[model samples]
Target chain A: MSKNGFTRRQFVKAGLLTSAGAAVGAGVLKPTGLWAAPAKIKGPVKVGYQAIMSGTLAGYGEFHKMGATMAMEEINKAGGIAGVPLEVEFRDSTLKKPQAIKNARYFVDSWGADFLAGVDSSGQALALAPVMAQLGKPLMVTHAATEKLTEIEVFKKGIKEIFRICTPTYQDGNAAAFVAQGLPAKKWATISPKYEYGYTCWKMFKGTLGKLKPGTEFVAESWAPFGTTDFRPHINTIMDAKPDGLYSVEWAGELITMIKQAKQAGLFKQIKHIMLPVGAAMDVLEGLGSEMPDGVWISGRYFFMFPNDQRNIDWVARFRKRWNHYPAYVSETGYSAMFAYKQAVEAAGSKEAKAVIGALEGMKMGSPAGERVFRKEDHQAMYEVPWGLTASNPKYPFKVMGKQVVIPPVEFFNRPPFEGPGTHPPFKG
Target chain B: MSTKATYAIYLGIIAGLAALGLLGDRFMVYMGMRVMLLAIFALGYNLLLGRTGLLSFGHGALYACGSYSMALVNLHLTQDPLLGILAGVAMAALFSLIVGFFCVRNTEIYFAMLTLAFGMMIFSLIWNLREITGGDDGLVGISRGSVFGLPIVKDGQFYFLVLFFFGLTLWLVHRIRSSAFGLVLAGIRENHQRTSFAGIPVKRYRLAAFVVSGMFAGLAGSLGAMLQYNTDPFSAHWSHSAEPVLVSLIGGLQTFSGPLAGSVVFVVLREIIERYTQNWMLWFGIILLAIIMGLRGGVMGGLEKRLRQRAATRKGGE
Candidate 1:
């Protein structure tokens, strides 16, 4: 009833307020963050996340927080789960395992968080696995790609309550193999930093690529100690191998530094084919920028330019609009894990750990990465890993995953959605 | 005040705090346990740097050895947590026997560098040995079982246990400071050449101090791992070794109660700062610099001087 208008009865008889009130109410729902509804949920669902939030790997944490905050915000604004708002808490791991485990416990024991997620370091993830069962809460690993986390190691100890939304390291190798199938250069050699991650990824890539393309003569292998700054000697050794193609398993800052060294050594000009399994990651692309030379084959867990779906485009646009940067693969992983947790909570219709675990088993959800299903048996998500050739464009800075080689999840996985050799299963599920 | 009286007052304060914790927050008890453990670490570290004039840069390796030994034994061996704790200290002592021999042969910077090299070696080993040590992934699932037949499921009980150990360690340090052996170590710290001339085996005394300090550190490490529920190679890294040194410096190396006060302040400050800002490390650095610069001889030294001046003035007035 307007102030200057007549009585409410007369106004109602004239139907003066109904249409206006309805239109305004409809407008209210259109904007984000105005979701107001009576909650069916009993209480607020609190999520605690641990990651490498300090030291050299803090950027990873930044992306993780951004992605996680985005999801939590969206869900909360969209009337929340069962009409109850979601909350998030974060702690820095300092890139150390003990700190991560302590942080996880603090969240569980001290803060009474409903669930846990966000591990950036593979070491931290592995350490958190067995303890997660003791903690009795689900730990959805957002970015750690180590195979043993979901495979025989956890199985050996009979550990559960651990699920990974990101693809495993073996899948990265498989994607590298798929891309190698199209290249003309047959002669091959390997160069990589010496570590479990490097050794496993290169070993699987060799096996798969060799299986796909025969007569790929193994020439030479050069290994660099982890944290080796000067790559001149390693580059010289690779050039001396005189292979037509080279596969290097390295990532992040070390990879970026070596690429500059390789350019100075002119190894890219010398070799007709070259590839790095993680060269196209958002950090790698944005990190190298114009320094990322042309013609090198690279891959990412998820690249912004690949597939070009409308959903992905919208996600990327919103990310750029918010962070002023393309969403990294790790960002997508964090984003997906949060959504998966939300779905599990909604499907269970309760926030109890056991109930959520039951609901999450074989639960299906959509993500910016793509549609993914959480396997009931081993708790692994079967998702695609894409690889592509590097190309420069005047429209934007940094290398785009141009000439994209989209590898389907089925090609690498052997009878997935349960047990797969790619997931490093000890036995057939 | 007399040193004995000071200790009596300190004990009374601790007992009061423990009593208050029975009705207060369990989180406070846990924090108290952490503070006590840190004091133990600083106490062990001070034995070498303050009493013996030996600056070791490799305490991290010994510290980590203690935790790993405890953690592994708890996971596999007897449910008796006391045995694990003893084993942890024993392992560190044994390691000290080997490492201290080489380290004690040198003095000053050479000794420091030797300890550093050894520490880094242990760190790398922990980082690489994925099969046995779990590499950087760390050893998890450490059991927080009982020492005797008494079960410790409550935070209050654990805090009391830690307090008991801390009091014991402090008493041990007190005894060592007044004993003949302790005087010889002090003499060696003052003048190793003169002490050698006075028919004392200076090198041997230094080595013994190193072993004893390692044992104390091991005890603290084992207790820390049990309380925290995990131990990693990062515990063996050089930076972890620096913590006690920092505490000893910020407190007063010469004062008996300095380590405890410093530990309480450091832990409390860190926890509180973490709640406020993500860049707490920066704030920590600023506070550390202020303490280092503003205080004359660390917190204890400055406080003691003020007390002595006040006593002199009161005596004059009387």
Candidate 2:
């Protein structure tokens, strides 16, 4: 390898020669196409990142990238992952699945990425998660919330290269459902963006809530298409149903639009209660602000203020000081993915994908979000999910999640290895 | 030179370029395949807009239909990439035929709206149908299988496969544009009322053009889906459809090579701008605005206009 950087030609040539050499020594050849030993690298631990860095979804992608950037900077400053400096190459996924997949290949086949990370769209993640087996590189999914990554049939067939550092859809739904069960109102309705994430969110919430409260009725449900700017009709339909409570799962900018419209109409006031678990996130909080109605239940995977542990406080302080904004949950997840990677790389004492996977399989690490343990069964990181009622506080300028409650991991979340990755949360609901 | 010689020269140029792409850097091979496939897509789109004088806002859905059919067939039906590609083409043509029947009756904006409506219907179907279409996740785990006996597992090999089709499509486009059928289509585009007075079936000719455009776009979409081994619902979106229209317009509408030029410019510009900053859409928007304003009839149209003026000036001097 050259001192500067290795060209794709050289890599291909070297690979061909090695394979040819192995063929000459037929007795020594291995079953797997590649040689058993991993290549020794002398340069930075390069990460190929894909996210929506442009267009409407830029903020989410930017925060995710920022988290990753801070993680890389911190790691390098402290002496990098396993004494090798870290490098990250960013590509705009344009919030599209095909683009994300293409970027994944380009990063490996073209950018010579050591490991791949980052995606903001659950749609991107759903398409990308299954194809990880072919990439043969560890992809740390930091932002996308699709449980389908681990729960889907193809993924259940044993995909190893894929891992998520963020909360999955079901877990978020489970916590939301668990919280909703305590409410006085038994009747509920759902208004969410139509997609896998929304489906999974409502399904899991309804499933868990149904099991808990057998009489609870889902009085109304409406699904607005993703990136929908107008939510008037959907809101009107939900109001007409007149359920005592509402379950919402909109994301980013669209969520803000939905809230503003819902508020304009007397929908929030008419409904006894409302639940927008993701809508209470920093982005929505910052955008909607005083417009965000009071006395409603909401949650974010990370609230930046909660946990308030020394480690988290310092991380947030540093992040805010640098980025000039409070760290979004996506930032925390992206940051943690890198740190988990650093831990795994150092623990394994190599950058080999297999070695890193082995080290990270069941590893427990404290993250800014909270304590996280990558469940060996499904390779999903189990962490505390922070949920709270949407309330304004004097200390913070934005909508503060009051009555803060951290939802512990569901029992079924961490399955025994013998039973397999566990059955996907039943679709009986 | 004879027609056969001209055809041979075009094939030769394409083959040479394909060989160069195979030996070029990874991005060149990757982006080159994308450009070629998109160029193919734009060719069909330009036929409707420039040759048939029919504006379609629905080819993105047609393109998506192509890629999705290819992906689904590969994933569930067969391992043969050829079969998947054929399935893609057939599906796209069928979609266009159904949509075109209604779309071709009206002219201009009505036709545009009809096509757009049909296109969004496909988009909604793809978006809402989570089980078979994989919803927004799209169809994944598609493989580019061996062709007859030759393998096409590598990017270089895939580039050659696409190149062969690119040449074939070029020849087909040339033939269609030059034939009596082509003359009738052009006549309809220029003055439909006059063509009707001449006793030509204008609607039938328009439908044929629409089908032809759909087939070519479908072919490109299938190859593109195979190129990535992935296809998403976005492929079937209005935005995807807009891509071909943009390429044809920017490269110069009404020019045979305009779509190809536009596709090359569009892909290369995005690739180049994306390298420096994530805000490629901003720069791209600005560049496209400038090109549309400065070049007017598109880059190729402007060039042709200049050439015509130069010929006129020379003749005046003589």
| Range of the 10 consecutive residues with the lowest summed lDDT in candidate 2 chain A | A418-427
Report the C-alpha lDDT of model 2 over A1-429, residue by residue, as the tens digit. 668888998889998987787776567655343654453545789999887777777788888888999998999999887667999888988887667876887788777887998888777776776556766888988877777675552236577888888877755687787778789888899899788778878988887788767899998889998779999999999999889998998878988999899989989889978888787567899998788888888777677877879989999899989899899888888888889988998888889899999999989998888789988767888887777877789988888877877656744252433233343332232
TM-score of chain A in every predicted structure: 0.86, 0.86
lDDT of 2 at B19: 75
- RMSD per candidate (Å) reads 6.7, 8.7
Regions of model 2 farther than 4 Å from truth = A1-41, A130-132, A153-157, A410-429, B1-5, B300-318
Model 1, position A112: C-alpha lDDT score: 81
Worst 10 residues of 2 chain B by lDDT: B19-28
* lDDT of candidate 2 at residue A328, scale 0 to 100: 88
- Which pairs clash (backbone N, Cα, C closer than 3 Å) in model 2? B60-B241
Model 1 Cα lDDT, one tens digit per residue, A100-192: 766776788778889999887777787787567767899988888777777644444556688888888766676677778788878788778
